[model samples]
Target chain A: MTRKREFTNWIFGRELRDSRELEERPDEERAKPYVITPLGTRVRRVLFCGLVSQKNADESMTRVTVTDGTGNFYISAFNSDFGMQAKAMVDALEINDQVLVMGRVSSYQNEGKTYFNVNPEIAIKVDSVSMDYWRMKTLHIARRKIYAIRMARNRPGSTATDVKAAGYSDLEAESAMKAMEKYPDYDLQEFESAIAAQIQPAAKEEHKSSKDFILQYIQANDTDGRGCRYEDLLAASQNASISQNELDDLLNSLGSDGEIFEVSLKRYKVI
Target chain B: MSDQVKRLKISELVPGTQNVDILVSIVSLQRKELKNERGESVYYYGILGDDTGTISFTAWIFPPTVRIGDVVEIKKASVREYKGINRVYIDAGSEVIMHPGESMDVRRSYSQLKIKDLSTAQPYVTVEGRVSSVREKELERDGKKTMMYYGDLDDDTGKIRISSFDKPLKEGSFIRMEGAKVSEYNGRLRMTLGSRTEVTEIKPSFQVGERLYDIHDISSPLGGVTVNGFIVSLGPKSGLVMRCSACNNRLDDIHCPDHPEAPVAYDLFAYFTLDDGTGSIQCTGGKAALLGHLGFTPEEYTPENKTISRRLVSSRLQEKLLGRAVVIEGDVTRNQSGTSVRISSLNYVDTDFMKKLEARMGADFQ
Candidate 1:
């Protein structure tokens, strides 16, 4: 049987890195093999947005690290005829730039330690709005799996339909069941805590003040019709003694809270 | 304000629950001004959630200080079913107290259903299907003429009518529409595209494929349907018939009153009840659709055997179709009598395929 194209799974770096098992279809040639994550995410293609942390290019290949605050995703684009497009995209990207990449996951075994990286099929430079949107969507997806797994663990011998009846999509329910069967001893609490801490950092009075300042700055400076630029916010944050990481986090949190809307790429508007 | 009221989780909410108290964080918030018969008033609507689940909420009197992601406790909230989904309503009688510094992760789930599974019960829905047809018309609203496009969309499961005002949809495009408003009109499910609805053209990993529907799921009258079932019984009119060559209408007698001089055409009409275990439907077809299955060729038909053809065709149809598993791809139509499928293509399911099909349907129905 001819295998069809696989869906691009929207996943975060944490879960993607946590995936350990790769399943292959030996019976069907040209079938896209997939990895089953500890959370039961059966993914072959993945779509994610993150900040480019590192880049190394050579005649043979281009390697880059993309981090989504939670963890890092290693992407390798081979400089070959079949991988020319991916290599060009990786070559064009710069460190600290936000980018969205959809790619196939490939795993290799070295010294008995299996490692995984993405082979990009499509890559585009995105802005904070797109980045934040991807973050929120991926976070919600992750949370749903967590909840489904928890439900499955709570109800012994529960089927996928039972989990689906608890208000989960069939895909999520099936994935949870698969995860339970494959990772029977996986620590749910530890994974949940780590994800939650990364998604929602502890609130502080200074952070609150900075958020207020960011909102006000956008409102006041968005007068030229084109929303407030990322550079303007960066300058404003620097003047207010807010670090780059804190500013990014504040922007993401504000975007997630629906207080600030990104009108365009790297432009903020108070909604 | 509500010391006696019982605090309930969002998941615990049911329809017609009165004087309910709950604490939840606002996951989504939207402020809207409504101008109605009573006059203009501002209200807030959004989704609220606890650790358990999420519920849509409406607040006629809400604090401006509270925004999305703020945890708040409500006293005297009422739960009511609106558009088939339970919603929490906060009116003047309700008091909302904000709890700053606290947060909650909202668990939101959307029903993933095919076109056939859609109902008005799901107010907002996301569906993926191919646009089967498109009809454009102009509508006058508030003295302004706006174009509205109405059409049908179908997937492997079934088909449904879709209409969009001001939003034009192209035919034959495989699109995924998110947050479309589902409504019912004259016993038909219709999905309307509103401003909030998001439409995206997607390249499906798998083939968009043919329209395959269970007998039970055939509600809307549509085309391009593939139904699998056993021919249980034949209709009274399931035999050979004479059609007026001019208009192609079936003639009750040998002579056509209107086109008396025109020659009559010999046509084989077969009507049967197709039962696929879940349900049954009346199906109709003509000689072109049934000749091969009936083991007859057009060359064999002549005016000489017109009298004997009826019995031969009836028995042949029964012999070839009755009590046998078959597949019919056709169009569904509704009239005063009921719903029936006009067969365009018919095929008998092989024994091996029938076994696999039964296994699949058994799993599906389970």
Candidate 2:
């Protein structure tokens, strides 16, 4: 079999319409007729076909980003919807995978750059990217989008219905609901800034110091050698610029990752 | 058997009688104090009088459970001295018997007595007079409800104050009074209407026109005057001893057997140092029993004589006395210390003036 035939089989079916044949037809008669503008505006309905760009997974959420030549957008899936069915879809998306994204076109302006956004209400990956990569990337984009909406709607006066209607995950909707109750005048921008300022730095530093500390502490003394107490760890981390809450988060991450085990209440030991 | 002294009238007897056996009608009986076994106390004393004279008496053993106006025969009662004044005392050893056969008509005792003739007798006598004024006051004394009605009465000879307890007599009404003891207060002869003093209003035979007076009207001209003032301070030394708690007898000493180191019960009294700011007087009397009846415990402000000094009398008593005009008939004497005037017999002027004042003051008086 010829490579062209293989490519054709991979893309479509046995009988395919040629590009010239589509060009020979009138604009209204074209199979996929759309316009892309440089100013982040698409005049006609456009099809975004690409492999998964990135994937990120956390305990609470998963996120995925998809990109074609024109622009890129994200989708998020929360733990509440991270069932086997959603996981299966997440498993299928991969980096560099060829996918067909069909959704409504939406736009957002940030930092003076207008970004064309498509909410991929539907997605189909092709043979170019692995199923695993696609799944992870979809999950990653879904989590990011979920987190963004959650952070946004946590501002004062934002309601759950508003967040949900803006296409946020259920977990995001729930968090926004609770935050709205607490600070009814919360500003969405302020909340997003706070989360960014809080989470980003810790997430960066935690990977290095926390992992090294756990490994060294476990190696020098057997799991119980010094009896890892939360208070003791807190004391050790006191000199750091990080806040108590951030340090606690790192410790939690370590515990969940099985690098340490909580031998007693608030006391940790190496796993 | 000295021929029973020829059935002597109380008027014929000496001013002080010792070991005198006499038959006399009890004009009034009041609760007084005596000591009991275990050195506790008891109440068995009161004023007993007849048509001729009246004296305070004490029953040493059993209390005489008798009412006012009862005729009683004292077989061998002896006179004793109290505070330099002589009083009669009867005991179980004395043949003190209540005689129903010798009943005396209470009203007839005052039937012939006129308000003007009362001054001639050495001993105080009752007189029927018309109430020219009546004043009713609602008061709370030591947490107990007490209403005092003070009024002036005139029998065309002179005017005297008629004070009713807990009730107000109608103004312009005539009332017959009996067993009212007389004393001098604030330089004026005053009569005290005790618990047994009977007061009943009757239709006046002649109407007395309304008389107008102010606080300044309480001069020497109104021989018996009624005035009111707020009680500023009270003291305990104003009256006699009180009954002991355990014994219920008047305690003469500071200590009692049950409470050997301290007196169990104390006779409390109030000396109202009152002022309208224009003038002031001090009214001292046995106030403990009255205060106790009104629900107050004696509080000692100073240690001397266990006296309650400079105390604020209850608001009810204050309201009853303060800012009102009263009529007092007795000798008005300047206190020996020359600090204030003392009116021994003080009563409210009456309700007629009070009603007019109330009308002028509008609802604020209420």
Best candidate, lDDT: 1
Residue B359, candidate 2: alpha-carbon lDDT: 51
> Candidate 2: where is the Cα deviation over 4 Å?
A1-271, B1-9, B34-39, B46-56, B62-71, B80-87, B91-93, B98-366
lDDT of 1 by residue, B176-282 (tens): 98878776655446789887778899875445556667665677666568887556567767888888889888899877889998888888888887755335788
lDDT of 2 at B93: 64
Instruction: For all candidates, state DockQ relative to the true structure.
Output: 0.01, 0.00
User: Could you tell me the lDDT of residue A9 within candidate 2?
Assistant: 7
All models, RMSD in angstroms = 27.0, 43.6
Candidate 2 chain B worst ten-residue window by lDDT:
B210-219
**Residue-by-residue lDDT tens digits, candidate 1, A244-270:** 899999999999999988899998899
Model 2 lDDT per residue over A222-244, tens place: 32344554543443343234456
